[model samples]
Target: MWRCKMVDLLIRILPVSAWKDRLIQWHVPGCAACSEKLAAREEAMSVLVQERELVSVKDFWPVVNRRLRSGVEREAPPSRPAWQWVSVAAGLAVVILTSLWLNRAPFEEASADLTQKLQIDYIRIGDEPARAYVFQPKGVNMTLVWIEKDGEGE
Candidate 1:
């Protein structure tokens, strides 16, 4: 029944023991949750002990150790060559850089197209406003505005 957080947590994490009854009295109504949990825990442990009484640990370890040793493979080869992994990483980096460089043309063309279409008459304030860019659509009167700051644009 003594139920400080550190002490109660220690009881819950440990194996059940004869000292549990003393714990119940020590905590009492001040710690009902801990007491009930410990009682249920004790009951479960008693049942488990009874079941284990029918087992022979003296006759168990050799069979278990034999099974564990037998399952180990003695002939496994190394997984992969280091040079192969290095070449794969290098090739991936090159491909990414090449793709990024090649896509710049399309992006630049789209920006130019957007700039030219923005000069239409009555299109409302067609000048490139400071901190802003206007992307006007083809054959349409609509435009999208993006506000850009000192060194960043969003």
Candidate 2:
């Protein structure tokens, strides 16, 4: 059986309430993968429990009721200023332009190699112009194709 399957089986076959303690004591000492997974699960469960304790219906129901009566859409204005958004947009644009400029030659060479290696023919089902894109991701065994009709009610 797979290691994960064995770990799952051990967890399921053990006691219900004390499964974590039993699994840690019995199984995790021998299996490093299971021990790491168990630690991550424990951390996630502790964080979930802490977040659950922080939330209560009584804490927000009064504010919601008051807002419903007062018809206020928001309690506070937007936290970010307009200049911050503009600067963020400017930074994003710069990053995008820099990346595209750096990768332009490599992308063009790859596209030329791909077109030379693969021949794609479009099928016309009707009078619409069709677009077909074929791509194979690195380290993947599958090629994906996307076909779409263009110029529709624009």
lDDT of 1 by residue, 42-81 (tens): 6778767575576655677798788779976466565578
Clash count for candidate 2 is 0
Q: Which candidate wins on lDDT? A: 2
Q: Which stretches of candidate 2 lie over 4 Å from their true place?
A: 1-80, 120-154
TM of each candidate vs. truth: 0.31, 0.27
Candidate RMSDs in Å, in order, are 12.9, 21.5
**Candidate 2 lDDT score at position 138:** 65
Candidate 1 stretches with Cα past 4 Å from truth are: 1-37, 47-82, 111-154
Best by TM-score: 1
Instruction: Enumerate clash totals for all models, in the order shown.
Output: 5, 0
lDDT of 2 by residue, 107-146 (tens): 7677767655776776453876677778777644446887
